[model samples]
Target chain A: MMVYVIKVGGNVIDNPVLLEQFLADFAKVQGKKILIHGGGKIATRIGDKLGITANYVDGRRITDAATIDVVTMVYGGLVNKQIVAKLQAVGCNAIGLTGADANSIPASKRPVKEIDYGFVGDVVAEELNISSVKLLLDAGLTPVFSPLTHDGKGQILNTNADTIASSLAIALSGSYAVRLIYCFEKKGVLRNAADDDSVINLINRDIYQTLLAEGVLTDGILPKLQNAFNAIESGVKEVLIGHADDVRKNTTDAVAGTLIC
Target chain B: MMVYVIKVGGNVIDNPVLLEQFLADFAKVQGKKILIHGGGKIATRIGDKLGITANYVDGRRITDAATIDVVTMVYGGLVNKQIVAKLQAVGCNAIGLTGADANSIPASKRPVKEIDYGFVGDVVAEELNISSVKLLLDAGLTPVFSPLTHDGKGQILNTNADTIASSLAIALSGSYAVRLIYCFEKKGVLRNAADDDSVINLINRDIYQTLLAEGVLTDGILPKLQNAFNAIESGVKEVLIGHADDVRKNTTDAVAGTLIC
Candidate 1:
């Protein structure tokens, strides 16, 4: 049986109505599945409430020690537990985890290159513990992960949700045919930024490069596509990027969103 | 093999040096074990920082909606993960959990009595999911639980740590001989409030009633002793209340604290 690793980000998670609708749809997916979530806006909002200023280099927020505490409270604690409880209410028996839980994902603190990202961690596929996760999955539990990982030395590092989903898909690909789904607001990767209806049905490596050269995919979408292609190259059976609501609607057809092959 | 359910409160947890020593000693215990922690002081501290006034009638803090959010962030999020990460550093493969995780413990919101305590849960042994916890324990994982539970209907309820430990012990008593230990700063139930060395070695049900009648045990110690006796009567193999440091020292003797019979 194939295992689905669904990645949901701030668009759905930050909005309660959308999150509930998305979770209801997510719960309907059959067989083994995992949910990886990101708390972007909530973390920032909480940080602001706590009088902590967010430091963003380029577009990505740099996680400092105090910011790590806020994210751990918001992402790993409040948001994660809230999702788990809601899933439980919907009959999905979900168990929430941080990287520290079961030492499932031991990442290293990002080295201070030109710009130090503070508490950010870069996860390697080989270092991700698939056995314990597999054990939980085999026992019929849906694992919901927060974008928090530990360095195995004691520090809980804030990580990227997309990276976490891709890493897990790649690591678990050996045992199960893994399908990684990146759920966001868009119906799929759109050809035009303004036109929601212009969903790109498929993007191969050649088309991806062509789009990149054409300046169609830049900024945040670039890294997302990069992670998707990385997962595909690493042996994940399929990767989909699409709307949160369309997850269950495309049960008969596997191509609901932008399919990366 | 016997399973130890050790409940630690904020006194030891709030102090960094004491918490480290306690966790190191806790990691050295033989057989299977679980840690249930309380965050009363920390919750209050955070709540105060957030400009929220803590409402307490008698002794227990009334968990209103805002207070619940603070406790969820502090107890279930920050304090719990910190303990899990620290335990990981000590060579203990600790998995942190809220009551909602794996639906391990389902509780109901406490019904309003003469005084209404909002968002607080009352745990029943039958509602506790021992099988899932046993599965995690048998797989060689030490579960560090936060004092938070869910109502199975999507609400996260703030629970008492001592109650959680007692409920877990009673529920798991069918399979494993459970020993419940409550660790705090005090040596034990002190005969004299001001004397550190005036430890009450043991207290049977009769002595407990007599002590209560004589006004020897009052205020905070009343509920603690009550929970201990409740656990003992519910078929827990043994229950001890003592200083955090003495946990590892009295391994052989098991008489380092106040034993409730």
Candidate 2:
């Protein structure tokens, strides 16, 4: 069996039109699948309304107590439930989830060094409750996860949506041939970085090394490519980086994204 | 097999001390159980912070668009997930839910009558999706539902927690002998309104009629008793009105509440 563990971020989440198209495409994808969504700028907007300031240091935003609560409401509650309802409307049997629910994804609070990322969680790939997830999948339920994990000590921790997608792919690889899809703003990993048509069709370890040696990969796409390779190394069958609009096409044999083997 | 469908309202949800103790006891209960929780004053508190005004008509609060979003965040996100994490800490595999999640409980928007309750949902007992719920319960997972439903058209609707509890009990009665429990501040139905210890341990239709004739039932108690009898008539094996502290006991053979048969 093939399972599609797809991730969509703020580019789609914050835009109603984009999200509708993305979810419609997502609902059309066949077979066992999972959706992990990121908390968009709506959290920051709500936090500002509630007087909770967003503190950022070294380019990474911190999840303080108040901020975590705001994100929990926005990501875990408002956005996640709304998406689930919308997916249900589109004929997808979507079940919304947080890591705390069914202990599906237990994580540890990030250990403080110089910066304390207050309520952020760092999930260990091996610790995911795959049995619970597999049961839901086997029963024909599509899980839509909000980017929230719990520390088992009764605390909801902020987590990266991308990390959740790749981690779940690696964990579920044993049960199914998993294709980890990362949906972003661009069409795919662009060879020219500016030209949308310059999407790299296929990249194996050899091609990736050549691209790196030629300085063709931009700093922004570098991390995503690295993550894709890591997921491939960890056991995921395939990794696809593509535009949210291209999700349905990317899922098929006629691919539309940068498929890293 | 006996299944406990328990409901706890604002009194239990608002107080951290009471909620913690109640969850601990709830976790100790054996066998299949489901929890339905009402949105507490925390919604109002957060609503006030977010500048969402609460509108009411002749005492019944209305759920406008903004207010619905706030309740969705507070009840579905913050409160529900928090309870899931706490239950996980106590060794309970709890999956938090809304009527929207998996479309487990489909509802219709309340009809516009004398006053329009903007986004409120009224669930038809038989329309409840018992199969999705039973899948979770049969797999050894407890469901914790927030008082939110959907109109099957991508809109989240505020619902009465009590109604949800009774509705689920009636819907699940075919597969399991359901014991519906409502946890409030009181230990049970009081023989004397002023005496906390004057608990009525059991009540049948005759006792209920006698109590109504004697004017022993208060305005609040009357509606609850009516709901209990309605549930009993609909197929629920037993309906227990008890204190949140007595949840574990109420689930046992030696019940600690007013058992309405």
Candidate 3:
């Protein structure tokens, strides 16, 4: 059986109109699937309103104690529950989750280096409780995940949605044929960074090497590509990078994104 | 098999020490169980920080638009996840839930009469998707629910935790010998309103009638007793009204609370 593990970002989550359309399309996709969602500006906005300042270092936001609580409420609570309800309205039996639920994704708090990331957690793919996830999927339920993991010591930690998506993809590969999809603002990995139409339809290792040698891969797409290839090496059948609008297509044979084999 | 559906209210929730002690005892109880928690002062505290007002009518808190969103985040998100994590830490395999999750508890928005309690949901016992809940329990996962349900058409509604507890007890009675326990600040149903130690060990319908005729019940305990008797009438094996500290003992043959049969 094939399972689609889709990751949708803050861009889609922040916009009500886009989120509704995306969820409708997502609900219509056949077979087993999981959704990992990113925490949008809503958390930061809510944090600001609550007098919790967002701390940043090297252009990345820090999950301080207060910030972690804010994210836990906004991302795991408000945003996640709202999405689940809407999906149910559209006939999808969606169940929302955090890593803390059922102890599904046990993660370790990030070690301190030059700067402390506070309550951010790093998940090791091998440690995921795939059996519980498989249990839900096998029982005809869709599990929706928030970008949060726990330290197993009663602490919920902020996690990266992209990382959660790929890690889950890699972990579930053993049980099913997995197509990991990263839904973003753009169509796909562009051959010409300036033109959205110049999407690279396919990228095997050979093409990736050639593209890298030619400096065609932009800095923004570098991490996403590296993450995708890592998923492939870890036994995920395929990976797709596409616009949120093309999620359903990316799940099928007529993929409208960068397909990494 | 016996399934205990336990509900703990805001008094325990607002105090960290009390909550930790309660959860440890709850985790140590020796059978299948489910926990439904109340929205504590934390929601109101957080809502105040976020500039959402707490509206009240006739001394009852109203679930207005902003208040519902705040409760969804605080009750379903922050408090629920934290409890799940802590339970996991104590070796209880807890999975946090709202009524919206997995559509386990379907509800309808309360219709307007004298008051339009915005976004408040009233759950019907038969409408609960007990199979999903049974699956999780059979899989050895303990469910920890927040006082949040959904209108089937995409709205998360604030529900009374006591109602949720009794409703689940009634619904699960067909599958298991159900024990519905409501844990609050008091030791048990009191013989004297002024004395905390005046605990009534047991109450049957005949005893209840005599007590009602004598007006032994206070304004606060009347609703709880009524709810408990309703559960008994609906096939629940027993209902316990006790302090949160006595949860484990209340689950056993050597009970420590007011047992209604």
List model 2 lDDT by residue over A24-98, tens digit each: 999999999999999889999999999999998886779999999999899999999999999998999999999
Interface RMSD of each: 0.9, 0.6, 0.5
- B112-189 per-residue lDDT for model 3 (tens digits): 999988889999668899988999999999999999999989999999999999999999999999999999999999
Give the clashing pairs for model 1.
none
Task: Point out where model 3 deviates above 4 Å.
Answer: none
* Interface RMSD against the true structure, candidate 2: 0.6
Predictions' DockQ, in order? 0.78, 0.91, 0.93
B117-170: candidate 2 lDDT, tens digit per residue:
999999966678889899999999999999999988889999989889988999
Higher lDDT: candidate 2 or 3? Answer: 3
lDDT of 3 by residue, A39-75 (tens): 9999999999999999999878899889999999999
On DockQ, the candidate that comes out on top is 3
What is the per-residue lDDT of model 1 for residues B155-206, given as tens digits with 9 covering 90 to 100?
Answer: 8999989899889988888899888888888888888889989999999998
Worst 10 residues of 1 chain A by lDDT: A247-256
